[model samples]
Target chain A: MLEVKNLKKSFGDRVILDGVNLTVNDDEILCIVGPSGAGKTTLLRCITGLETPDSGTFLMNGQPFDPQGTKDSDRVIGVVFQDFNLFPNLSVMDNITLAPMMVLKETKKDAEKQAAQLLSELGLSTKGDLYPWQLSGGQKQRVAIARALAMKPKILCYDEPTSALDPNLRQEVAKIILNLKKSGMTQLVVTHDLDFAQEIADNLLKVKPID
Target chain B: MSLNYVFEILPSLFQGAWLTLQIFFWTLVVSIPLGIVVSLGLTSKIRPLQWILEVYVWLMRGTPLLLQLIFVFYGLPIIGIVFQRYDAALVAFILNYAAYFAEIFRGGFQSVSVGQFEAARVLRLSYWQTIRKIIIPQVVKIVIPSIGNEVINLVKDSSLVYVIGLGDLLRAGNVATSRDVTLVPLLLVALIYLILVGICTLVLRRVEKRYSYFK
Candidate 1:
């Protein structure tokens, strides 16, 4: 349901993505793999409208994903940053429900219910009352994933979803992704972990790092 | 010291102290929200707006507050924008202190992690909603001490009202001490200041205690 046609991006004189094209079919786990400095993260950012491409276009469900000149573009896409961008000030529940309540115009009660369900499904039910600082890195990332899911987004982008975790925790995260695949969720995961991609991804796009 | 003199000076000075308290309370009530607004202006995405707000804050902060007071209380009347001396003093105090409070607020706001802001943006909270709900709550917790400092300073600074003959606590003490060179009455006024500042410190400590769970 997402398309990036001939996307090119650069910072100063250095090019990150040069004429890269990719498409993600609905209900598929699309793994974007490359070595370090492959612009995989930048590619994810462009798709999510967090960064503008220097050229080409990104379309989500046949509509342009342009946040630069638009009033509200963030509602259409959901992202889980590698660093786990949770609000330290808010409880896990608040962090998850915030987007649904504020942007989606869902009632607080409804948003809380959905958030609780998502957290429970992600094996984070008990941690909902706690802040990000109280959770392990794996738990925090799971909460971030729950937050992305709470929005009921058409496309879910995960930037190196399991990179920060220990080997044991990475398996737990992979299981969660595999479950999402079974449930038919559209996911675009950027990672260097080849084994995890092989285990969960239905389609793999390998980006080449330029010299 | 005659009990009658103590009674005479105490009653009048008490009234003047009440006036001081009134000015102090109202200055906070008006200036704090104004300070936050000015802070947002300085941090706005638009460069020209940010520049203008920075200049405004700089002009307000760089000059002596006494000069600002004189400019508002004395200079404004020269331009036919007449206000009562008390009104002029209050206006000057609010504007002058708002700039300082704004700077403190901006510092508190910036101290929040950039990641928190990105999270808020991704959640699609409007600029105003994110500021009010996420950013400001954290900022309030952080800026409590600085706000307390400014408020206590505000109590003493209320004495500056005497310059325009507004009859605040210091002015009354000055008049009382001039009449009686023994200085007991002035000492009483100083005691009153101590009590007020003491109460402020106690209140702020309670506030700091409530939010101390964070760090």
Candidate 2:
């Protein structure tokens, strides 16, 4: 569902992602592993249009994803970063419904309805009224996933979702990812979890840091 | 010092306080929206916009309010843009306060994460919608304290109207002090200022509590 080609990115004199190419298929789970500073996150960010590529072509369902020229892409894609970029000012329901209300123009009632349903499924039903700071790391990750799913995107990109959590909490977050994978959501995850990379991913691409 | 003179002038002082209240309320009503627009312009992505906003902010902030008051009340007639002294002072105060509030508002807008902006963009929210629904709420919470500070400042600054002979609270107090030759009326005027500041502090403390997540 997503195609990335010859992606090149440089910060100042150092090249982070040099001539990287990857493809993500529909309903597929791909795990990308790399050493620190390997540009795995940068590459994922480029695909999600969080950062502009120095030179690359991104295609979603054969439609062009040109960051410089296009205001938006044709496909719906959601991202969950390692830092859990929830709006600290908004409640869980507000965070989850943000994109739908703003991007999709969903009414507040409809957005709240969907947010309630999704939060319930993620085991965050009671926490919907709470803000991000009130939640634990694992719960925040679940809210992040619910936020992405609330977009109803064709592809979900995760940038090391569970890396910040402790081992026990990591497994809890892993369960959420496993559920997404089972639900047939096309997901691209940049991760260091070898077990998840080996067991759950339909494809695993190991990336090494550039010299 | 006869105390009856102070009580005799109380009715006029109250009337002047009422005028001060009007000016304060109207200026805030006018200046806040003006500040938001100025802030949006200041943060515009385009270079020309950035330049224009930069110059506007610099000009408004660099000049003294007293000078700005004189310029509005007395200087504009050189180009035939004449106004009544009261209108001139009102315009000057609104414009001056708008600039400072704009900068404060820009800080508030900056506090929202880039992630939120990107999420709004990806969701296909129009730029206006993103600002009205997403950006404004965040900005409101962020800007409340500073805005409250400015609101209190504006209450005192309204006394600057005396420079233009608009007979605001300070001018009325000045007139009363000269006639009564006592310090109580002046102290009473200071008390009024204190009361204004105290009310603003209470309201803003409540606002800060409502948005304490920002802290």
Candidate 3:
């Protein structure tokens, strides 16, 4: 289980996340839904260590979690950015294998083997040698998910996973999220698509901007 | 225009070209890395260091390379910072080119988006790993044409060493021309410079091709 207590964040004088709290059970999907300017993405960013909360505490399995300690939090949390932030200079195979080899000290063969597995699982088996620019929107998103999964994070976060997809692709993403849940992956998704959230979220947290 | 005259001046011109090549090679060896470091400092968060480097770049870029060489060779002696003619030309050339390269690298660094850094952070990549694997490849792609421009300029700018009485290629040509009362040596010198720059262009094109794997 992961718990966030009394999270608060402000940029200059504008408060984004004000004293927010949430919880996610193991092997569950948690969706954060809010309109524009409601700080749903900000909350996810704070949880993923992309932004520092003014004051907050994160607990993983009842132990305190420190997102600022990169080494400790890196393996514990992963993010699939809105734009899919794949390394443009790298092919899909290399993008997925880079962190495993560089940070996890896995051999190139081992990392490539695991990346091939993930690509096959994500229906990207033949796309490994292709660059991100060549992939369609849905394919890129799946590659981003595969890239994050390669790290084997305890929890994965997504920022607007369905924002760029069409209706059919949105359903495709929902199915992928459901499949991840079946494999016992914890997830936090922030999006304004309430219907999509309701379709995949085991629980939903709604946020409103603090004036 | 005679082959005999060309051969007669060839040895002396070759000697001067050797010195010119030495200055060019050493200046690039030292200045390229120095420029990368200075560019990192420019983008760093330290305010005073950024200001200092900004002023340094401004000073170096604002002045002519010839004037800088003259200042290092002739003007610094009054302040007790005397250097040999060859050393003075090298010091001035390195400092001046480093400034231009710094600006070029700074632009390359800025072109990278903030998300690239954030992605590296979440992936547990150390600072150096991020720079080596992710950042550098992208920056190199973006900055190669700019770097090629500077490199070609450095080849031509090496002639500025002649102002310090160093017998560089242009100076040797000038000597032969004045002594023989003929323009042939100067023409040969121009041909030599064209050949050097042509080689650089071919090599740079190959480098650019290697990085063409991505857009």
Candidate 4:
């Protein structure tokens, strides 16, 4: 379970996320929706330790989560950016296996074995040798998910995942997230695409702007 | 002017080129990795360390190589730091080129996106792993052309070591010209530089092609 109590963040004199509180259970999809610049992404960043919050206590499985030091929480939480942010220089297989081999101390053969399985599940089996630049937006998004999944995180977080997709591809991303959820992966999606959000979210959190 | 005269100068020219090659080879062998270390210092989180590296880079860029060569060869002995002619020239060239290469590397490091670091952090990669696997390979691709330009410049700049009486290729040409009263040695030196730079351009182009997979 993940819980945030009175999470507050400010940039200079501008307040982004103002005294927000929320709780998320295991294997649940929680969607955060709000107007642009209302700090929805900031909240997600704060949770992932990408951005430091001014004040808040975050807990995952009853342990305090520290944003500055991801030592204990990196494996517990993963993020997929809207842009995908895949390593352009590496082949798909290399990208997916990197974290496992480096962080988990798995042998290359073992990591690749797991990666091959994950790629097949994500329908990227045949595309493993290709670089990220060669993939379509939808394909890149799927690879990003596979890359995150390779870490075996308890919760996967996404930032405006569908914002860059064509309207035709939005449904595909929604289905992918739903599939992960069905497979017992907890998720927190920050997106403006509410219809896509509604299709996957078991619960919703609204982030309101402060004057 | 005669083919026979050019042939007579060949041995001397080759000897000079050989010495020039030595300076070039030694400087490149040491400076590339040293530049990376200095670049890391420049980007380190410690403000004082960063400032120190910044000032070092600044001083190196601010002073002329000629003055540096002269100082290392001549002035250092006053401080009980005597050096051989060859070693003094090598030290000066490596320090100067290392500074240049460090600046070029800094540009390469900064060219990488912030997203790369964030992704690495989220993936639980150690800081060294992130740099070794993720950042450096990408930076190499981005800065190949910039580094290539500096290397070609190094070939031309290697001639400056003659100022310290190191007897490099240009110095050999000077001796041949003064002794033989022929312009052939100078023209030969020009051709050798062209060949060296041509070979480098080809290698650098192949590197750029290999990295084309990314962009």
Candidate 5:
């Protein structure tokens, strides 16, 4: 479980996230639904250590969580960016295996084994040799997920996972999120689509822009 | 214009060409990596270091290469920092080319998107690992054409060693031209430069092709 309390963030004079509070339970899907510029992404970024919050406390299973720390936080919190920022220079296999081999000090054989497993699980078993630019949008999305999951983070966060997809792809993403939840993976998805949120969210949090 | 005269000066011109090649080869070997380090320094967070690099780049780029060569070979001895003629020319060439390459690499570094860095950060890749694995390959792809241009320039600029009385290709040609009172050696010198530049272009194109596997 992850808990965010009294989170606040501002850029220059404009406030984005103001005293926001939320909690995500283990093996649960928490979808943040809001219009554009509602700080939905900001909240996810703050939680994942991409953006710093002005004031907040993050607790993982009741222990203080520091996402920015160099310890286990990196392995504990994984994020999939909105655009699926896979390393363009690397093949899907390398993209999934890079962090595991480089940061976790896993042997290349072990990393490749785990990446192959993740790729198969994500329905990209045949696409591992291809580069990110060669893959379709949905395929790239799956690769990004595989890359994130290879790290074995305790909680996975998505920034507008379906924003760039078609309706069919959106349904596919919803199915994937539901499937991940079934496997006991905690997920926090930020999106503007209320219908999609309603389709998969075990709990929904609506954010409004701070005027 | 006669083939006989051309043959007569071929030996000396070849000797000069050898020196030119040496200067060009060593300058590239030393300066390319030095340029990368300087470019990283230019982008680094240390304010004073950045300022120093910026000023260094400005001084090197803003002035003439010819002037720098003269300063290193002639003027510096007045301040008791003296070097041999050949060494002084090399010092000037390396410093000048490094500055230009540094700017080119700095541009390459900036062209990479912020998302790449963020992704690497989230993956827990160390700073050096991130630079080596993620950032450098992309930057190398982006900067190849620009770096190729500088390399071609370096070939021609290596002739400037003639100013310090070094027996580089152009100096050899000049000496023969003045002694024999004919322009044949100068024309031969130009042809040699074209061949060198052509070879560089081919190698650079092959390198660019190798990197094209992704984008």
Candidate 6:
């Protein structure tokens, strides 16, 4: 289980998130929907330890998540960015295995074995040798998902996953999120696409920007 | 131009060219990595150190390298800091080129977005791992053109060793021109410099192509 309380963030007098509270069960897909400038990304950033929250507690199984220290927060939460910021220089396989091999100190053979399994799971079994720029938008998204999954996080976060996709592609991503939820992967997704949100979310929360 | 005159001087000019190549090659070997180290410092969070690097870069960039060559080779001896002719020239060139390369690397670091860092963190990659596996690879691709330009400039700048009485390529050209009382040696020197720059350009372009698959 993941929980956040009284989450607040401000940048140079403009408050982005204010007194926000959230919780996600072990078997639920929690989607946060809001309009542009509504701090949806900021909320994800805060939880992922990218943006420091002004006052909040991000707890995973009752333990506070630390952005700067230890291996727990990273192991607990992994995020797929809106742009799918895979390492451009690495092949898809390397991107997926980088964290596993480097941070986890797994051997090359072991990381590659795990990455091959995840790639096949994401339907990218043939794309291991290809670079991120070679992949289509949907393929990149799947690779980003695989990259995140390779870390074995308890909660996976997606930031505006469908915002860049066409209507058809948005549905495709929605299916992926729903499939992950069915597999019992806890997910926190922030998106403006209400249709996608409604179709996949077990519980929906609204994040509003501060005035 | 008589063939005999050209051939007679070829051996001496070749020797001088060899010295020039050594200077260019060694300076690149020493300065490129040193510049990268300095670049890391420049981008680090320490304010006082960053300030010092800023002033150093400013001074190096603002002054003519020729003046720097003179200062290190000649001016430093006023306080008992004497150096051999080659040492003084090499030291000055290394410091000057490292400053320029540091700025190039600094720009490369700046070009990488915050999103990359966030993604690395999300993936649980440590800070050094992010830099080694993710950030530096992209920075190398982005900064190739700038580095190429600086490297070619370094090839030409090696000619400045003549001012310190190091018998480099341009110095050979001068001695031959004075002895033979002709401009042919100067033409040969220019031709060799052009060839060196051409080779560097080709190599850099090839490296850039190798990394092009990223974007």
Q: Which candidate is the best by DockQ?
A: 5
Could you give candidate 2's per-residue lDDT for residues B2-100 as a string of tens digits? Answer: 577767888888888888988898889998999999998888888898898888889889998889998998899888999898789889989998999
Alpha-carbon runs more than 4 Å astray in model 2: A11-14, A62-73, A193-196, B1-4, B213-215
Model 6 lDDT, residue B139, Cα: 90
Query: Evaluated on chain B only, what are the TM-scores of all the candidate structures, in order?
Result: 0.94, 0.94, 0.98, 0.97, 0.97, 0.96
lDDT of 6 by residue, A12-115 (tens): 89989878999999979999998989998888888887878889887888888765456555368879999988888899999988888888889999999999
Instruction: Name the TM-score of candidate 6.
Output: 0.95
- Candidate 4 lDDT by residue in tens digits, A12-113: 999888889988889899999988977898999998888989999988888887756757553588889888889988999999999999888889998999
Clashes of each: 0, 1, 0, 0, 0, 0
Off by over 4 Å in 1: A63-74, B1-7, B213-215
Put down candidate 1 lDDT per residue, A36-155, tens digits, no spaces: 899998898777766788998777778777644334443566788889978777889998988788777899999999998998898888988898888989998989989988877777
Candidate 1 docks at the CAPRI level of acceptable
Q: Top model by lDDT, which number?
A: 5
Model 3 chain A is weakest, by summed lDDT over 10 consecutive residues, at A66-75
TM-score of each: 0.92, 0.91, 0.97, 0.96, 0.97, 0.95
lDDT of 4 at A2: 89
lDDT of 4 at B78: 97
Give the clashing pairs for model 5. none
The sequence of per-residue lDDT tens digits that candidate 1 reaches over residues B1-215 is 78888888898789889999999998999999999998888777889988987888899889988888888878888888988988988899999889998999999988987767766666667777788778887898999999999999999999988888798998888888998886878888999999999999999999888775443
lDDT of 4 by residue, B133-169 (tens): 9999999987788889888888889998888888888
- CAPRI-style class, candidate 2: acceptable
Question: Considering only chain A, what is the TM-score of each predicted structure?
Answer: 0.93, 0.93, 0.97, 0.96, 0.97, 0.96
In model 3, the clashing pairs are none
Q: Score the docking of each candidate (DockQ).
A: 0.49, 0.41, 0.77, 0.76, 0.82, 0.80
Off by over 4 Å in 6: none
In Å, residue B167's CA in model 4 sits off its true spot by 0.9
Q: What local distance difference test score does each model get?
A: 0.85, 0.83, 0.92, 0.88, 0.92, 0.88
